[model samples]
Target: MGAEAILEKIRQNAEEEAAALRRQGEERAAAAAEKIRAEAAADAEALLESARRSAEELSRREDLMTGLEARKNALAARRAVVDEAFSEAHRMLLALPAERWEALISRLVLEASETGEEVLEVPASDREKYENGLLERLNAALERSGRKGKLTLAGAPGKMEGGFRLVGPVYDVDCSFEMLLSLVREENEREIARLLYPETRAAGE
Candidate 1:
């Protein structure tokens, strides 16, 4: 062959080799780009799943708090009702006949005769029953004790409840309805609160 023809053939082969190398490089770059795109898609999906899970957890917590608040309010309302009912019942019991008052007075006058001729400061509403039934009992107790025979009734007005207050020369004894009510309330406060607010009581305990 001529020298020019051989040189031309050599140049054509070199060009074809260069084209193949370029094609291979382009394919490699496309493969790398596809891998990077897949990695980015996976990362975005993971982030979205994490966000969804957080929102669901928050919703559940909110629902739980709402239910707890509702229960607390309902318990408070029930406690109020129970307190009112108890108060009414206590008042009604206090307004009964003076049978209990006469018994209490008999006990007090007996004790008083031992010390001195003690006068009782009783409720004005019970004066009739006291004069009728309690006076004879008081005199008998005084005779038994061999003490002075003067069980005077106080002219001062007091509670209408069926209890008495005895005041002697040196000492005094209070047996009023108010005093009894206060003692009862103090003793039952914890039980009442627990019964009314069981859930809160458990948490506190």
Candidate 2:
């Protein structure tokens, strides 16, 4: 063959080889890029799932905290109501009218006079009520009830709220309004709660 024709053939073969090499490199690069894209998509999906789980956990914790706070507030409110009810009752008893108060004192004195000879220690505020007529009335009631009517009032008044104390030789009996209510409260706190919260009682039952 001629030299020019041989050289032309050699150049054409070299060009075809270069084009095949370029095509192979491009295919390999495209495959690598596809792999990288798939990996990135999987990583993004995993991150999204983790974030969703975290958000759900945080939401649940918040809801639990809110419920506990609400329950605490409700319990506090209920306690306040019960306390107010007892306070109102105490105020009413302390403000009893004169005639009713005298009768109550007489009744209490009669009940407390175990020996009927105990010294009656009354509050200074109520000393005049007993001195005027209550002491005589209490003695008569005690005598009628088959006890010695030898009760005497103490010279110095006692520290009391709204009742008297019987100071005997060996023991003493406290019949103050505060004492009476405290005793009643100790025995009947649940009943009072039930009356104020019938729904709670019904649920418990």
Error of 1 at 126 (Å): 1.1
Error of 1 at 100 (Å): 5.1
> Which residue pairs in model 2 clash with each other?
none
Per residue, candidate 2 scores C-alpha lDDT tens digits across 1-205 of: 1222222222223222212222223464355335533433333333223223433444444445556676555445545544554455556666768886676666666655666788988889888877887788889888999989889999999897767677877556666666544543443445545533444766998
Best by lDDT: 2
**Number of colliding residue pairs in model 1:** 0
lDDT by residue for model 1 (104-202), tens: 445544643434366667778777866776766687677777866567788885654645665655445554555434333343455445555555565
Alpha-carbon RMSD, each predicted model: 44.2, 44.4
For residue 95, what is the lDDT in candidate 2?
Answer: 74
Give the runs in model 1 whose Cα sits over 4 Å from its true position: 1-76, 95-101, 104-116, 142-149
